[model samples]
Target: MSNNSNTLLGVLAGTAVGATLGILFAPDKGINTRRKLVDEAVATKESLADSALDLRNTVAATVATNKETLDTKIENLVSDASYKADDVINQLEGKLKELKAKNKKLQKS
Candidate 1:
């Protein structure tokens, strides 16, 4: 799990523990205390669900952004390579033409 997940779990766990301790020590009726604990548990569950959703969204966004960046970088690299290859082909063609011309001149002489 990520740090955000761990931190959320810790916070939720701490809230439950603290609430339970408070309920146990308070001079409230048993039924009231139980109801309060149940309510607190439900709220904590909802909070955790919300946090999990938020974290998932954040991770998905980060992955999408990274993928876009990688794609652009790959496109640029391929374009650069294609240009370099074309340049090399042009130079080789020029050198071949020069060699052919020299060969023809030597044959005539």
Candidate 2:
């Protein structure tokens, strides 16, 4: 179902095919052929382990990059909202001052 399983299955099938062919065609004794098969299996396993590790590292790096980008976007959004809020507050303060001045002038007159 998973990608890893599929890849492993493919690797195993190829190894089996190769081993069968080797046994059929080899001039060496049965014991030597078996030893070679075992060695090949071990090498394949090690290679798969290395590949899995590399995949994990790549996934981790991608996650970290995406998280950093999201954090930066959020920070920018907050900063923009704060700036707009301050602008609105400044405009309102100015209007209030003008209204108060007009009221004082009217009262004195």
Candidate number achieving the greatest TM-score relative to the actual structure = 1
Per-candidate clashes, comma-separated: 0, 0
Q: Write the per-residue lDDT of candidate 2 for residues 2-27, one digit (tens) a residue.
A: 58757876876687678768776989
lDDT of 2 at 68: 100
Could you estimate the TM-score for every candidate?
0.85, 0.66
lDDT score, candidate 1: 0.92
RMSD of candidates 1 onward, in order: 2.0, 4.1
User: Where is model 1 more than 4 Å wrong at Cα?
Assistant: none
